[model samples]
Structures are given as C-alpha cells and as structure tokens.
Target chain A: MNSTIARLTATGLLRGWRGLLLALLPFVMLALALLVRMAFGIDPEITSGLLDTFNLDTVVPLIALIVGTGAIATEIDDGAIVYLLTKPVARGRIIVTKLLVAITVTLLFAAVPTLIAAIVVTGAAGTVTWAYTVAATVSGIVYCAVFLLLGVLSRRAVIIGLMYVMLWEMLVTGLVDGARALSIQHWGQSIAAELAPDAITASLSLPVATTLAVLVTGMAAWFATQRLRSLTLAGDS
Target chain B: MTSIHIDRVSKWFGHVVAVNDVSMTIGPGITGLLGPNGAGKTTLLSMMAGFAAPSAGTVTLDGDPTWRNEQIYRHIGMVPEREAMYDFLTGAKFVLANAELHGLSDPGAAAKAAIDTVDMQAAADRPIATYSKGMRQRMKMAAALVHRPSVLLLDEPFNGMDPRQRMHLMELLRQMGSDGRTVLFSSHILEEVEQLASHIEVMVAGRHAASGDFRAIRRLMTDRPHRYLLRSDDDRRLAAALVSDDSVVSVEVDSEEEALHVQTSDFGRFTVRLPRLAADHGIRLYDVTPADESLESVFGYLVQS
Candidate 1:
C-alpha cells in the first residue's frame, strides 16, 4: 500500500466539517456513557445491554459508514480521483491504501470511543471493555472495507450501506436465526460472547464468527480492488 | 517525443456513438481539437487519457495501450473539462498532492515549480473553493504540470478565462510546444485555435473533418461560399448591380425584410467590392452582416463539404 495515497486520504478526511462531525460522535458516545453511569448506577446488565445494542450494533456501523465511504466517495464525487487514477501505481494498491486510512479513522473515531464508553459504564470490568473494544474494532475494519468498496462501486453507497446495516443486519437478523448467522453484527457479537460472562447470550461459536469475519473482510477488499480497476469515469455528455 | 495514437477508435454509450471510428496521431507539437459542443471531443480525450475505454479499437501512448494502463500517465498529463476539483484543499496542497501521487521525490519543489509555471503562486495559499474561475483553471494547469509529463492534454482550457489570462496560457502552451512537448488543447473558438495551434484536428459530428497546418484549416474555413444579408437604401438596385459581377454567385431581393441575400464565391473580393460598388452606384449600404458566421454554421459547412 502506498503511504502517499494514505496521507492524501487522511488529510482530505480532516479538511472539512465532515472531520468535525467524525470528532463529535465519540464525545457524544462518552456523554451517553457518563449519563448512564450516573442515572443507572453502574449495573453490569445495563452496561452489557448498552454496549451490545447501542455501541456494537448501532454506533460502530454508523461511524464505519461515515469514515469508510467518506475516504473515497468525496474524492470520486469531486472528480479529484483523477490525480490518483492517472499514476503509475497499481489500482489495487490505491484501494488498499485508502481502505487502511478508512480503517484507521474508524478505529480512532468508533472503536476507541466504544472502549472508553465500556470502561466508563462498567467500572473495573476491563474484560468487558476489552471484549467490546475488540468486537467494535474488528467489525469496524470489515465494515469500512466493505463500505469503502461500495463507495467506489456505487454512487448511492451510503443508502445501500445503511440498508444493509439497519434492515439486513439489525431487523432481519434480530428476527431470523439463519439471517443472524449471516450478519456482521452477529459475527462481532459472537466474539464478544466469548469475553462476556455466561449471563450474555452465546450467539455463535467463536471459530465460525472469526473465520467469517476474515473471509468477509478479505473478499470485500479484493472485490473493491477489482471494482476500482474497472471504475469508469462517467463521460460529461 | 511522446505521441498519442488513436487508431480506429469508436466510443459508444449503448446505441449512441460518441466518437465514430476516429483515427489520428498527435505528435510533438501543439494540436487543437476543434469541434462544436457534443462533437465527441470529451469522449475522445477521455479515451486518450485512459479514463474510459474505447468501445472499439485502441488509444495508445507511444505503443502502450492506454486503456487500463496506469503506467501511461507517467508520460502524459491531463486537464479535464470538469470543474469539480478538490475544493477544500489549498492550491499549493492540491498541486503538492498531485506531485506526490506521481511519486516525485521532491514533491514540494515540483509543486512550487508547477505553481510558478502557471503564475499561480500568488493565490496558491488560498483554498481552491475561494479561487475565481481563471485562478482555478490555472491551478488545474499547475496540477497537470506538476509531474512534468511529455504529453499534455487540455480539454477546453480557455472556456472561462478573461482575455489577459487567455493570452498568458496561450503563450505558455506555445512555449511548451516549441520545447517539443506534445500539447493538445481543445477549443470551439476558431480564433483561439488560430492564434495558438500550429497544427489542428477538426472534428464535426463525431468524424475527423480535417487535419493539417492551421493555414490549411483556415483556408478550408474561409474558402466556403460566403453568404451575406445586406440591407441597403436601394436593395433592388444593389442586387441588380451585384448579380452582374462574376464574384457574386446569386443575389435575391427579399421585399418583406427589404434586404439583399447575396452569395459570393470569392470572400476576399466580395467583402471590399460590396461596399465600394454601393458607394459608386450612389446607394447607401446600411448593413452588411455575414449570415452564417456562428461556429455552428461554420462547422456545419465543414460537415456538409
């Protein structure tokens, strides 16, 4: 992966109000955690529910959508991608570099905040904090790669990504057992199940979820590179 | 010297053929791609730049196929017609990013040199969102030049520039051409092409209409039958006198408009002869307007011919 491309992507991400929005999400999550600790009195049950429902299932995918798609979609929309495209570097390298930057941003903006929130909500529960952090980090990386590829492949990437996160993962997976097995959230929660006490539901086996996450991330990244190689610059007719 | 060879290239969007079987070799010099809007100039340039693949045939830079070939960009620079650049970045940062993307060792130095080349150093610190159209155009030029590619392709480079900026850019392009860099810029304005380009490739309705030295193209343009709408105090008398001249092919008197529709075979002689003959015949020539002087008509004449 090219460092120059990553540098360009990183700088571009921080240059506008979009950067401010990304910075704000984590603080908002921390505020919610502090409010919950004060009002709800540091209950482990409440902490697990908040971490599972809000942090892992909702906030992680939302931040991934913003950072992942923002990394490449803005460039494509502005036509600034021409500079990167017309270079001697391999197209896959560019895709991988941008994905790396997107994942880094997701980790900073999404996973770190969820970890801090976990610690705040459950005082002295380092395992809970670490488990949820790992889950959010891994899922955020996979989501970022998948959605970043979506950004390259489609103009309506955000809409499609939101549908997958909200409808397919949250709605359908919550209802159907088979659909849950296909969800990124469930895969992440299955890993989380291993770290959490037996009180939380054991969603899936650890090996299955870990293997699926690896496969999805790898396939998404590979597909994105292929899509980018053939990405057509629409003619101004 | 770097050259772009478009060999039997045809690009189509479904059933609509944008460029139809176009074949041209652009060598080391400044060549103008002259065509009306929607005449496939952008499509042709896109294919050459390797952004879009030709539906048929090939676009190559020095023998390497341009489509799906990222390495071709090492020797080619492109200034696209679109206005959507990275508006958030300062001009210097934008050019510097372009330099770095090209893998230049000293990106800062290359960016500075490119900014200086386009005389954009004065506004390089401002965000590109704040730049005027001319400043943005020059910045785009600087970005394209940051890598110092041998082949430079600009699509409608002077679309919105003021006169002074236009002249400055024309001078820069001329210098680049003299330095043996293959520079190709597209323009619909004949004067723009006539003033700068030593060679030109004219496209009309998705076909190569003509290609050669500027003078040859200029002659092809001027040598068409000249049509004039003449309003005179004595339209009938003017027509009567003008019809007898061998240079005048046909003269019709339209009573409703009280004007003379004159078609002349010799443009040079008819222009001077029309007014002088009216003066000698004691007729007041109120107006002598070239009927078909717009670019569309000129291009249409070329297509028809």
Candidate 2:
C-alpha cells in the first residue's frame, strides 16, 4: 500500500477522457431515473427494476472493467510501468496499491452514483439504496481486481471484459439458467438479496457468494503481483 | 566503487536469442554498449537493470543477484528507451512522483535538484505531451536521477536530441562518471560512443564481439582485410607488380570486368605501394576504389572474426 503508487494510479485512471466517458454511465442512469419518475408517475416498483437491472447489474461491472484495466494496462502497453517498476518498492505492494486505487475509482464512479440513482428511483423503500450500494461495493472490488489481473494478462482486456459481461453474463446466462451460477452478476445479485430478498434473485447462498467473491478477487490480485514480478519490458525489436 | 557483473548471461525469447552467452563487468565510470540495430543492446541493458531475468547465469551488483531483487533498485537508476512516462502529468509532478516512489525523506528538494540537474526547471511545470523529443528525454533523465542511485543505465539516451542538448547531456554524464558513479549507456553510433565512452563493449548480431578501450576497438574495426578494385591500362602487368608486394595478399586479374581485384592484409602498406608499383610497371590507373566500407560490414567482420 504505497501512497505514491496509489496516487499515481488514481490520477492516471481519472484524468483521461476515457475516465470521463466511463464515469458518465451512472449519472446518465440517475438522470434517466429522475425522468422516469416524472414521466411514469413515481412508481417505486418500476424504479426498483431500473436500479436492479441497470445500475447494479450494468454499471458496477462495466465501470470496474474500464477503471480496473485502465489502472495498469495502459502503463503496460506503453511501457510506462517501467517508471514505477524500476523502484525498490515490493511488487506485491505495488499491485495491492494499484488494485486498491482501481477499486476506489470503480466505487466512486459506480457505487456512489448507483446510491444516488436508487434514492431518486426507489425513494429509500426497504433500504433499497443501501442494498444496491452494498451490491455495487462488493461487486466493484471483485470486478476491479479480476479485471486488473486481466489487464496484466492481455492487452485486449477491455474486449475480453466486455464479452464476458455481455455474452457470458447477459446472453449465455440469460439463455441457460444454470450458467447464472458462474456469473459475477449472480454474486452481486446474491449480495443484493440480503438487503432486499424480494428485489433480486440469488443463485447461491450469501455465505458462498461472499466467499467466492473474496477468494477470486484476492487470488486475482495475488496472481497479478506474481505476473508483474516476472514482467518483461520487451524492447522495440 | 559500484560494479555490475553479468556472468555468462543469455536471454532468449521464443526462438530468437537476443543476448548470447556473454559476460562482462561494468565498473564505476562511463562504459558504452555499442551495437547496430537489433544487436541486443536494449535486451542487455534490460537484464543489467533487473527488468528481465537472464535465461542462463546471472547479473549482479557487488555480490547480490539483480533478478527478483527489489533491493537492487536502491543502487541503480534506469532510463528506458521508450518515451512513455505518464504524459498527462507536469514534468515537476512526474519527477516528484518518482522521488516519492524512491521513499526520499525530502522528495521536493530531490525532485527540484533532479529537474535542475537535467536543466529542465524552466519547462518543469509544462505537461510532458507538449515537450519536444529532446525535452522529454531530459525529463526522463530527471525522473531516473531523482533517486540519485549509484549505477545509472540509459538505453539510447542521445536518440533524437539536438546538438546542444546532446552536448549538455554528454557533459552531465561525464561529470557523473568522474564522480565515480557507474554509468552505462547504449548507442549504435560509433562517433557517439567514441566521444563519450572511454570504454566500449561492442555487440554484433547479439554476440559480444569486442570489449576494452575504444582505441583498440577502433583498430580492430579498421584492421579488417581491405578489398580494392583497380582498372589499369595493363591489368596483368599491375597484378604481376602488386602480387610482388608483401602487403598484397592476393591479386586476381578479372578479364571479364577488365580490372584487378586485390585483397590486402596491410591496408596502409598497400595504399602506399599501389600507386608506386603501378607507376613502376608503367600501368596508368583508371580507377582505384576500396569496397565494403559500410559500418555494418565492419560489424559483420567483427562478428565473424
């Protein structure tokens, strides 16, 4: 948890237009929630559906993919990671710091906005804002860590992340009910179930989902550090 | 004095061997890594700086292994060949960030001194994207120098620099070397190495071809077998005259091209005697041209020898 690495990673992920574009998703969802309340006559049921489907399911993982990969992938691609890497700091500490920074950025752009959208839409019914916030928070950590590892693993992390979210999560999981058990969205849905059992469906029990999320995220972050340790700064051959 | 020892180090990527079984010791002073393009200069530097592990043997600072050793970085600073350094931050911010990463107690002062060392203080506040290529290179030097490590490794530091900037950096590196800090920089240009490096390690086709003083390396480069093509009024007569000279190794009369192709073991003696012998033989020389004078040919000859 080096503060210098954390600060640099945070600044790098937040400054680009890429950051602005990814950060706008939840705000746009918030505006749509407000507009729907005006147009559809303040129906909590419909707003609850919007928050569950769009905010928690869509925004959390998407922002996680963008910010998680942004945190380290671009540096790897342009070979700028060499600047941080040529330091005496521990590689594990660098990974942990960058992962924490990416997760923080994901929560700021995803969970906070989702909380605002939930209040605007569900109007605090059944502690709905808090439930989705919890869902976003847990899933943001898992998604950021996993996608951050993906960033280290491949230069095409965004494309692969998008495919996993859209094809594996939405299409395949939608068609095959059993496949939902493997989805990161299902883990978030399981978390959302704890606060609002009637609001979302859960594929696994709360204990199992929590364990899997923590295990996967923690293992991914550890693996990322190991990969960075042996990373090759290949020349312009 | 700090010394980096690369003992029997070799690096291979898939099927291409970038650095062959090579070993050398870089001590406190300026040593140039000289090679043509794709001669594994960067690969060698990367291994020395501990960014990449060698496929065989070791790279060490003093007695400690460089690979997988984070502690080695405290004694080393590296300016990579790539220009990317988080272009969004101002040069001051970037240098300060490097200072903080090194865990310096007074990061601000270190950053200021580093920026001043590279003479980048005036444009330190500007974003790196707006900087010229030379300016960006200097900024990179500042960032690497912020930690004030004893061993500094720079890969192609003079590429894309103006004359003044090049001279300024040369002077700075010279001063650092005089201060008894180990400085290793890579360059493909002979003149660049000749001007700055008192010692040079030459790499030709991924093999360590020569190592020692630049003057000795220069001799080896120029001492290569000289090939000359001559057209004379009487090719056979000149060939007979040239073969009699001790400097001339072989003389072939090419009736097809109407010229005498000569290979000489002694270049100076051959040049001095070619004109005199042709005159003595009453053979008017039409053309005298030395062939294969390209630098690549010289490197190729070094590799072969």
Candidate 3:
C-alpha cells in the first residue's frame, strides 16, 4: 500500500465536517450509555440490548458507510483523483490503501466507542462488550469494503449506501427470515452470538458468516481495484 | 526524444462523437492544440494522457499502449483542465506527496525543485485553498513536473492566469521544448497559440481540420470566404462598385436594412479595398463590420477544405 495515498485519504476524511459527524456518533453513544447507567443502574440485559440494537445495528454500519464512501468519493467528485491516477503506482495498491483508511476510521469511530459505551452501561467486564466490539469491527471491514467500491463505481455512493444499510440490512433483514443470510448486520450478529450466546440472535452459523464476510470483503476490494484501473476522467463536456 | 502517437483515434460518448478518426504524431517540441470551445480538444488530450481510452484506435507513447499501462506514467505527466485539487494541504505538501507517489528516492528535494521551477516557492507553505486561480494552476504544474517525465500534456493550461503568469508559463514551456521534451497544450485563442507553439494542430467539430507551421495554418484561417456588412450613404452605389473588385465574391443590397452584404474571397485585399472603393464612388461608409468571423465559422471552413 502506498503511504502517500493513505496519508492524503486519511487527512481528507478527518478534516471536513465528515470527521465531526463521525466523532459525534461516538459521543452520542457515550452520553446515552451514561444516562442509562445512572437511571437504570448496571443492568447486563439492558447493556446487551443497547449495544446490539443501538451500536451494532445502527452506529457501526452508518460510520462505515460515511467513512468508506467519504474516503474516495470526495476525491472522485472533485476530480482530485487525477493526480493519483496518472502515476506509475499500481491501481490495486491505491484501492487497498484507501480501503485500509476507511476500515481504520470505522473501527476508531464505531468499535472503540461501542467498547467504551458497553463498559459504561454494564459497570463490569464481561463477554458482551468484547463480543459486540469484535462483531462491530468485523462488520465494519465488510461495510467499508462494500462502500468503498460503491464510491469508486458511482457518484451517488452515499445515497446508495444509506439505502442499503437502512432498507436492506436493517428493515428487510429484521423482518424477513431468509434475508438475514445476505445481510451484513446478521453476519456481525452471528459472530456476536457465538461469543455471547444469550446476547444476540444468529441466522447463519459462525463458519458460514465468517466465510461470507471474508469473501465479500475480498471481492469488493478486488472489484474496486479493477474498476479503478479503467476509470475515465471525463472532461467538462 | 519522446513522441505520443495517436493512430486513427476516435472517442464517442453514447451518440455524440468527441474525437473522430483523427491520426497525428506529436513529436518532440511545443505543439499547440487550437480549437474553438467544445471542439473536442479536451477529449483528444484525455486519450493521449491515458485518462480515457479511444473507442476505435490506440494512443501509444514510444510504441507502448497508454491504456491500462501504469508503467507508461513513468514517462508521462499530465495537468488536467479541472481546477479541483487537495485544498487542505499546503502547496509544498501537495507537490511533495505527488513526488512520493512517483516513488522518487529524494521526494523532498524533487518537490522543492518543482516548486522552484514553477516560481511558486514564495507561497509553497500556503494552503492551496487560499491561492488564486493562477496560483492553483501553477501548483498543478509543479505537481505534474515533479517527476520530470519526458512527455507533458496540459489541457487549457492558461485559462485563469494573468498576463505575467501567462508569460512565465509560456517561457517555461518554451524552455522545456528546447530541452527536447515533448510539450503539448490546448488553447482556444489563436494569438495564444501563435505566440507559443512552433507547431500547430487545428480541430473543429471533432475532426482534425489542419496541421503544420503556425503561419500556414493562420493563412488558411484568414483566407476563407469572409462576409461583411457594410452600411454606406449610397448602398446601391457601394454594392455596384464593390462587385467590380477582383477580391469581391458577391455584393447584395439589403433594401430593408439599407446596407450592402458583401462576401469576399480575399480577406486582406477586400479589407484594404472596401474604404477606397467607397471613397472613389463618392459614398460615405458608416460602418464596415466583418460578419461570419466567429471561431466556429473559421474552423468550419477548414473542415470543408
């Protein structure tokens, strides 16, 4: 991976109001966790419900979508990517580097905050916090890969990504039994259920979820590189 | 010396043809791509720079296909027409990042040298967002020049520059041309190309219209059939006298407007002979406006020729 691209992508992602938006989600989670701890008083079931429904089901994918699409989409929209594209560097390397930046941002903003918020709500160390954190991190990688590819392929990546997370992953998968197998949130839920069986429900087995996660992440990243290879810098026609 | 060869290159988007079956060899030196706005100059340059592939032909640098060849960039540098760049970083950081992306061992020094070459060292520490349009254009040039590639392709490089900045860039391009680096820049203005490029290629409506030395192409543009609207005290008398001149193709009296519409075959002779003809005919010429002088018409004539 090229460090220069990585650095630029990171700086670009963090400097705008996008960075503020990312940071705000974690603070909101922390504030809610603290308020719940003060009012409801150290309930493990409440913590599990809060972490699973609020953090994993909501925050992780949202942060991943914003950071993932923001990492490359802004550059593509502004036509700043031409400087990087017209270089001797490999296209695959550029994709990998940007994807890594997206994943890192998601983890920092989504998973780390989930871990801290779980501790605040539970008031004790347990498998629930670690389980959900690991699940969030895994789901974040998958979401970032998918959304980064979306960013490369479409100018309306953010809108498309939002629909995927809200409509398909949350709404449809939550209501339809068969659709869970195709959902990113279900894969994370399966991993979480493995660690803390009583905390969350799993539709697919651990082995199947792990395989699908790895396959989707690998394919999305690979497809992104292929798309980037033949990207057209269309003039202002 | 490096050369970019576009062999029978044509690019079309959906149904609109941008570059049509155009073939040319841009060898070492400064070559100006002169065309009117929306004449496919940007599309042609995009294909040469490997930013877009030609639909029906090939663009190669030194016999290597530019499309899907990342290695070709080692010898090619491009300054795109768009003005958007990394706005948060200082110009120094941006150029340095470009140098590092090229995998130069001494990226810092190369970036500094490029900044100095563009005469942008004074504001290198300033954020690019704070820069004027001309400064941003120069920073774009510095980034493109950091790797010191053999072939330089720029699209509308002088769009926003002031007079001094334009002159400085022209000098820099001329120096690069003399050093045997192939520099090709696109411009719509005739005087801009005439002042800079020793060689000129003209495009009109997606077709390669003319090519060669600047003077030859300039003559071709001026010698096309020129129409003029002449308002005189005696329109019929002026039309009668102008029709007798060897340079005049046809003269018609517009009774509604009370003017003479004269089409001339020779621009130089007709412009010189119009006033003299009116004076000798004892007719006072109020206005003599050269009609059909738009760039499109000038280039449209070349397409037909």
By DockQ rank, best first, the candidates go: 3, 2, 1
Candidate 2 C-alpha lDDT tens digits along B225-267: 9899999888888888888889989989888988888999988
> Where does model 1 sit among the CAPRI classes?
medium
- The full ranking of all candidates by lDDT, starting with the best, is 3, 2, 1
lDDT, residue B175, model 3: 91
Candidate 1 vs candidate 2: the lDDT winner is 2
Interface Cα RMSD of candidate 3: 0.9
Query: Candidate 1: TM-score?
Result: 0.92
Candidate 1 residue pairs in clash (backbone atoms < 3 Å): none
Q: Which parts of model 2 are misplaced by more than 4 Å?
A: B230-240, B253-260, B275-289
Kindly list the per-residue Cα lDDT of model 3 for residues B108-133, writing each as its tens digit.
Answer: 99999999999999999999999999
Evaluate every candidate with DockQ and list the scores. Answer: 0.62, 0.75, 0.82
Over the stretch A98-181, how does candidate 1's per-residue lDDT look in tens digits?
Answer: 989999999999888988898899885578788888889888988998899889988899999999999998899778888977
Clashing pairs in 2: none
lDDT of each: 0.87, 0.88, 0.91
How would you encode candidate 2's per-residue C-alpha lDDT over A18-112 as one tens digit per residue?
A: 77877688778878988987778668578667876777667788899889999999999999999988888999999999998998888888888
lDDT of 1 by residue, B11-35 (tens): 8889898899899999999999999
Candidate 3 per-residue lDDT, tens place, A101-164, comes to 8999899999899889978887755887788888898999999999999999999999999999
| Minimal lDDT window, size 10, model 1 chain A | A195-204
